[model samples]
Target: MHLHKINKVLICILLTYTVQYLMLPFPDLSAEEGVIFENPYKKTEKQTDVTQFTIYFTKKSHLIPKQDQVRLQSVADFLYRNRNFEILISAHSVEGKTNKENVLISEKRSLEVERFLLIHSVEPNQIRRLFYGNSKSPNLTKEHEALNRRVEILLQPIG
Candidate 1:
């Protein structure tokens, strides 16, 4: 009787462990998150004579600098002159922060650029914003890596 009781207890413990292991969720070992920031601009396959430009964030703050506006205005002017082109706004961030925080920061930066463009009379429909928060770093240098926190403007031909 004592032997039978010990065997039953061991079997129950083994079954419990097996069930727990089977119910555990697996981690996402794939690289789907790694590709979120690649080619954020979604540039179309149309040709245009307008020159492209870029605006860098360089930090996690919500402020947009005046010089950045100057650059954006220049792009806006080019868009005004050549109304047949579309602007792709790709926003990026640094790699130290949490993914959620990085995504939010990138989004804010993109929105700031979008607002600046709209204020300058650029059509809302003509501009598209892409947030890549820290997934891709343009500047690999440690000091300048923060500069990778920026938005790139890609100009493509519109239909």
Candidate 2:
């Protein structure tokens, strides 16, 4: 009987040691081991230098240019890393277009950008969309109107 109890005690001790040995390679839950996730698109510098990014569109078109897509991707990466931040999209259209046409175009532009962000994992609640169709510009030159037809992205803290 005494020998049987000793054997049982030895078995429990050996099992405990084996489990601890197997778990030694992994990090503790509380350990600080840099970023938990690896983001290939992460930027080296802090984004504090710029809180806003813009995507320009061609005359009467809402299609996002390829270069702007890359820029927006960078912004998406930033937003992914910082969950507390929210995005504000201000969409504008060319001033010379009819008010109704500009409204539709501006809405399409904002929705397109919002969809991009949503597809990249941003929550719908974190986005606010605003459209200023045919909003008068200080300079009505073609170049200035071109600038006006864009989606302006602003990142700000939620709280």
Candidate 3:
């Protein structure tokens, strides 16, 4: 009789939770600032005229690859010329690793990019870093994993 009563209580509690969860409203995803930043890789007509580009990294590797050096240097050179602009280095990694490990890897990647820009004479103040672990995957496909492992550089006017 006691066990039956306990099971009934558990069922009631779970049902209450389910009902509450089902009734909850969806979250608001709109930006509070009203300014939406477009992915630099996919520039549409409206997103054009924004100085932005992306440099890709390999799996589990933070150092900028040899082929990508020229591209990264170009970004650094652009910063040298554009004194009013700040570069946002949004780094991402996808290894299906733990959150902590993913974040660490992404941070390392962003830092490596920052170091390279600094070496190329880009102003340190003009560089902003954002590290996102595997949390933001572009897609689940094996091919998309490579796409997700990248650093996107977007140039914005300093406020």
lDDT of each: 0.71, 0.74, 0.76
Q: What is the per-residue lDDT of model 2 for residues 1-159, given as tens digits with 9 covering 90 to 100?
A: 999999999999999999998788754655442222222223223223236866667777888877567677777787888889888999888653488888888999999988998899888877889987867444456645656777888999987
Alpha-carbon RMSD, each predicted model? 17.8, 14.4, 18.3
Q: Give the TM-score of each candidate.
A: 0.60, 0.64, 0.64
Q: Which stretches of candidate 3 lie over 4 Å from their true place?
A: 1-50
lDDT of 3 by residue, 1-159 (tens): 999999999999999999997776764543343122332443323222236756667688898876457667777787899888888998888774688988988999899989998999989899899999877767656656767778887888887
Collision count of model 1: 1
RMSD of 2: 14.4
Comparing 1 and 3 on lDDT, the stronger one: 3
Worst 10 residues of 3 by lDDT: 41-50
Which 10-residue window in model 1 sums to the lowest lDDT?
33-42
- Flag regions of model 1 displaced more than 4 Å: 1-50, 138-141
Q: Report the lDDT tens digits of candidate 1 across residue range 41-105.
A: 43333212235655545457645766556666778887777778778988887744687888888
Clash number for every model?
A: 1, 0, 0
